[model samples]
Target: MTAPLAPPGLHTTSLDLGGRTALVTGAAGGIGRACALRLAGAGAKVRAVDRDAEGLAALADRARGLAGTVEPHVLDLTDLDAAELAAAGTDVLVNNAGLQLVRPVEEFPPDVFHTVLTVMVEAPFRLIRGALPHMYGQGWGRIVNVSSVHGLRASAFKSAYVTAKHGLEGLSKTVALEGAPHGVTSNCVAPAYVRTPLVEQQLTDQARAHGIPEERVLSEVLLTDSAVKRLIEPEEVAEAVAYLCAPQASFMTGTSLVLDGGWTAH
Candidate 1:
């Protein structure tokens, strides 16, 4: 059965970000791509940052005719100084770049754990550090961290990912407190498993780690706790990111807007 649409004006987002600029890391694909497109649609010039040159090019093409524009920027987040530099002068920062490696704690590579934290946690700190100056100067800015259910909960074989996300949650709140006096707001959009390349790769790794067929991983693992019984779409998460940046969310800060399909309720 088709669901009824909301009355026209009653449900429109009506967010306008004209003349603003937004920086979305990992914009080459998945949630980052969706966010870059969403912010651009709201008339904000979007800096699409990712190391994937080809993917960035594709995103630039897709953003053509948008209300604002997509500017591709190729940079590895591991370069902390460069990441910070890239964020300067931006009014909006969406720290959506991330990675995951599923392995038992005993077998997880130390190097990989370090890399994950560097990219997901440390880089965001630098980016926010860089953005705050401009934001504080203007007394207005929006910082949206694309965290995960891992930020609030835990699963075996995801130690590093869980740790990094938990840390990100803390960092976001600190920024909120400091930036509040400057008209800057910081928040996190924590979603359950969203349909994306990262999650696709996790299915294979999870199957290997759990000694199960890949086909069984989704039902037996990924969505086992989600009452909704499906993965969220990237665009759906993007809409939540957009809402936080809209004027209506001016008073909301330092907390997470969870899109977890009731996973935490149980």
Candidate 2:
């Protein structure tokens, strides 16, 4: 029998975002951390925003030696006013901060659902509002929303997360439409279960919620619809964000760049 050949290697970009100011929420870890570092690598001054002060500090340490600087801005996304202020003067905005509580709507706490919506949807709206004046004045900007496969598909016992992501999709599109004339582009990067701290915590929560063992959660709950039976890497998703911010993607707006490992193919 003939041996099978390897598939083509994935290619990355060397985008130059020099002299740009980028604000990335949830920049302390996971996809946010990767995005912060990647933007810095492309020569942008990055404002890394997150609630975890210590995590943000560690991220700054790791960001050393990149082509640009990373200024850690420690703040919780729940503070809507502060979130809007922090987004001011940004040439690129990545709304990546979010919270999740997986439970049936009937069983899920209403307060938790509200918090998720506030952080994932409302805060993004405020941030975009803050960033627009600067972008419009300069006649250029990029906004990338870190949505999820859940934004396009529904999964059980994840009412809060699903609702928030779907709402985010709408928010991104609205921003895209409004900002088009001002030389700003808005889009969403929807990824399936990227290996992140949030998702790691979900493994435990999902296990408890479903009464299943933690080990089985990855296969049964997370990757059930993914044709590629592996969690996505944060760097891979970050690369997509970078691509959206690059000059080549200026014409690409009001669209969802999905990195779902074929989860949505069905």
Task: Please provide TM-scores, in order, for all candidate models, with all chains considered together.
Answer: 0.96, 0.95
Q: lDDT tens string, model 1, 77-177?
A: 99999999999999999999999999999999999999999999999999999999999999999999999999999999999999999999999999999
Looking at model 2, which ten-residue stretch has the lowest summed lDDT? 1-10
* Candidate 1 residue runs with Cα over 4 Å from true position: 1-12
Top-lDDT candidate index: 1
- Which candidate leads in TM-score? 1
Residue-level lDDT for 181 in candidate 1: 96
TM-score of candidate 1 to 2 decimals: 0.96
Query: How many residue pairs clash in model 1?
Result: 0
The CA lDDT at 19 in model 2 is 96
lDDT of 2 by residue, 26-145 (tens): 999999999999999999999999999999999999999999889999998889999999999999999999877778778999899889999999999999999999999999999999
